[model samples]
Target: MAPRSPPKRVSISHSFTSFFLGFLIPCINAAPLGPESDRVIKLPNQPATPSISQFSGYVTVNEEHGRALFYWFFEAQSEASKKPLLLWLNGGPGCSSIAYGAASELGPLRVGENGVDLHFNEFAWNQEANLLFVESPVGVGFSYTNTTSDLTKLDDAFVAEDVYMFLVEWLQRFPHFKTRDFFISGESYAGHYVPQLAELVYDRNNDTTRYPFINLKGFMVGNPVTDDNYDYTGIMDYAWSHSVISDEFYHNIKQVCDFKELYWSTECNALVNQVFDIYSEIDIYNIYDPKCLINTTSSATANKIKIDGFKRVTILAGGYDPCYSPYSEMYFNRPDVQTSIHADSRGEKWVSCKDSILNSYNFSVFSVLPVYEKLIKEKLKIWMYSGDMDGRVPIIGSRYCVEALGLPVKSPWRSWFHNKQVGGRIVEYEGLTLVTVRGAGHLVPLNKPSEALALIHSFLSDEPLPNHR
Candidate 1:
């Protein structure tokens, strides 16, 4: 057997922005905030004063290891105290929730194109629920650990434990939110993070000896990575059905590739690599969307070139800026911005997705289906949504994963409307509901904010997606 290569180091290139504005504020000592200290007075380059209260700081999960996770919280626009708390995570298994979940996707304020300013997102998720975004694990974003070995020990269990710890301590710091109905949401690899963490929270809540109950009512994930077998088979099928690859190539892959295998043969790897090579030319995240021509030098493209011997792709029509990733990296890395957010005081450079964390992250769990099965049996409200255009964790794969659950159909699949037009389709199962966001890609909120907002509103309300306009 050919020896496996060492994991490639992934680098995300920065797009330089010259615009700068000077803002001065009194220097406060860098420490995890008391309820008041964490309040964001103002952010540098903010286009307009914010109306809603925003708080950001670190919550130490492990005192011995000096491990802390950075978090940004936004209160609901109208009913600040009454809304449920919704924790949003972004899954790269290493991606910063602040970058994808906050800045680029559903945050109340979005990082502007120049990376030097912020703009209000009218359709932000906080419109319906208090939004919380965290840079989790020990090494992603501004979250850090004093012990370097902690980085190497990262895995699903490690992440879930630390995050639960963060939640416990965080609830202590903000005691009022302890009773709010809580729901966890994220996309991509978060498919793993969300369920695992939810299960952990569920188990802990049931423990009579445990302190500080987390009011976790339910969770929602989009384009989530579920079972390896289903995801693999679905990817190839989606690609071929979508005409992303030729029939000859698709048949060749079918002949040489066995999606059920734990490891692929070298020939399978070569065929998959060729598939990714073609995906490289397009924005695999959103196949129909134009590639961000601005930062062609970015190794972010290279980082996605191979997904452990499988390829992912998608397409979307234009409107959203594809350069949001680089812009987020540049904005968060700024000294003033970091200070305003009460991030790491040492001025450690921030990246949207940390390559080190991704490289070292132990992909020990092959499937989260069992966790889903466990949770489904409980009286928890679970919903899964997929961007139909997201090739990475395509709707096809999500459907397959959901189908594998073998739940009775509570509602037949039907078109759901938004703006008097068919937004996508929806169906309700015995213990789960699946929705599709039409025209959206991997990042649904970023790709289609209005529709995404509507979807979340429905989920939080426990109502079905609008069947008619």
Candidate 2:
């Protein structure tokens, strides 16, 4: 067997942006340049404010399917060349990471309530790492497969293969980041995405002569659905614990249908509908977050907040407004926005989650625990986090999944803090770290930006979550 490659050394100094760090320093243009000269976004809302650069384009992942994945990259605010490269993905199996991740959660500019305007996100992850958001698998966001057949099926296996190729080809477009410390990150369904993709990198990196030797370090995920069994059980536990549903109903649902059927199958459709009916009053994504019933009407002013539920959520939460969804759709669907970002518009418009794709998606592996077991043996840095308020993939489920690994605890469960307040709670295991963000739901960065930064900094820096007893 070829000798395993030595792990690359990484620098800990991070780029800080106001979004994540409470302040922004001008980005130092020290990295080798590519794609910036052509793909810069002149957003219709805020055209000239940002001095920092961004890149967006397509990289063909499958030639036979004529499949190409779309990506948007945000360079760090400082020392661009030296920072680690972090890829961000959103779950939904059928969702666009560009919309949910870059637009609402951690992008430089978040879509305002009207859906067409923009505002700065004070906690964009690019402040600390070079952020790359990809629309993976195909048929999600701007990524597409040209197969004329009406059937659409994207499973974990195909996602891994296509994304692996996407990264290989994407490097050809921007070669400077090839040797930089690379990490994979995603949320929700990306729980599956971040790991499956990382396993490929971990396996390939063992090759002595693999082209471009991707300098992979480790990975992080938030509110991930790692194991279908554990995730389903976790959500049920979360709902019951949070008083969202009755114990009798929870047990009845479990007795009637498997969690895997929650999304598909008529076997338990009526029963699942019962659970959803109780969950109907709330935003299943962030149970506590107020709902935005409609998109903001097209308006002339960037600050003109929408009248419906979207703006109300923003006003009530005082941080993340669930209303960003409609606005993101509006902005991304614009001809100018598509042209500015060089988006492919084979589809009518971008939906945050593509229902058809989610319904038609082929289930490959129910649990990534085996993959996790192998990667753990390899000693890769892995962190799992959850928004405490999020019921969809509750912290309880993620905690149960990690504990199933049975890794020894390096640090006993404790509260971790930022700015002298309880940021979250953390428990460290021999091979992984588990975190719960206080008052945060599925979207940690959007809900608790500072804590999210603190968490990410700890992961990227290879440090323990501060022992704020």
Candidate 3:
């Protein structure tokens, strides 16, 4: 594998910064705060059965602005105070959390046959810490915004403000958890969201400038594609090394693939074709998650062997792609999952998948822009992980992200042996650790549930990971 590249820190500022400060802070209660203008709104949500071992609930974050965040809280119902609180952000800049994080992965439920109901997930992350899976930035999932005319543009800064505002309001609603040690976790675009939000919480923690209700402890990101340049190069390299494409094609993509170019050229398309051809031959899962099966276009014809990719590369959000049909020959259909994810939201009884309750804004990378400097300066902990077989934000892409951090490796990369088999590997650095989950893809919690849960548990409790010296 090639050495990872460091992040090219970009400084960006928008006109909303002033409005952000004004709306976020105000004088109130001689206690250094403003009156709570928001009220928690409960939606018509049915709870997961008791046999499922988790709690489902939603707290209104900004009802007045028509922005509300919905979350699934999972816990074993421990009366113990101080249980860890985990805020999970699903990346899409505009994707639904229930689609990827909830139904497909860590949540205690899996989308069943018709996406009509759920099944108990044995490896739910809530078995350890109280986990909150939220559909953020309004217009995503059951979350909504009253103003229909609002621009749907999802940028970094907008997300941070809404997240911070929600956190403050959420803590107020769940006051019992206000002091609990909190960690933010997410994947793909969330790779950027988690850290940026964490910085905001940390900044407010030390300064008398904003809300002090957030008790943020740490953060985690999986298969993050933060740096645009690194992600493109990393994906191509992965495709080439895995024999997913030819060396010739790889060379062309490496030399000519510029992200700024909105669309792929003929050369790029050809390379993609070759890569998809290779992918058809490889299996996406070991135990065979029926969903991971690839579609092929090959048929024994009079002469040439041909293949075609999926008709639509349906990206629900945050670089997470859930397959509803196989490309080409076998168009495997998971209508249930399709309905559950809003991939087919047009079906009768459809609910908005985007959050409409969030404040009107665009995403800004301000938090990350000044993060490493501030956090690195504070000796804070930042962790990154990835499932091996995820194609959208593959493990190789994650490895590349880790390499760019440029932190000295505290522990060299090595397989994390489990039950006489390599489950994953851990690379510890000065203030960060990058991990790879074996036998798991895009959604680790779904493909490798037990392992994903265990990894997160160890991360939260500060336990030394097994097999790592």
The candidate maximizing TM-score is 1
Clashes per candidate (backbone, < 3 Å): 7, 8, 29
For model 1, residues 340-457, the per-residue Cα lDDT tens digits are 9998735455778777788777677778999989999996889999888877788898999999999999999999999998999999999999999999899999999999998999
| TM-score of each candidate structure, all chains considered together | 0.88, 0.86, 0.71
| Runs of candidate 1 exceeding 4 Å displacement | 1-34, 296-319, 345-347
Candidate 2 shows a clash count of: 8
Candidate 2 has which clashing residue pairs, if any?
19-122, 19-123, 20-123, 91-189, 115-327, 292-309, 292-310, 390-441
Q: 2 or 3, which is superior by lDDT?
A: 2
Residue clash pairs of candidate 1: 286-314, 286-315, 287-314, 287-315, 288-315, 288-316, 289-316
TM-score, candidate 1, is 0.88
Error of 3 at 298 (Å): 28
Candidate 3 residue runs with Cα over 4 Å from true position: 1-60, 77-80, 114-117, 258-370
Candidate 3: RMSD to truth: 9.4
Give stretches of model 2 more than 4 Å off: 1-32, 36-38, 149-151, 208-212, 254-270, 295-314
- Higher TM-score: candidate 1 or 3? 1
Measured with C-alpha atoms, the lDDT of residue 140 in candidate 2 is 85
Between candidates 2 and 3, the one scoring higher on TM-score is 2
Q: How far is 59's C-alpha from truth in model 2 (Å)?
A: 0.7
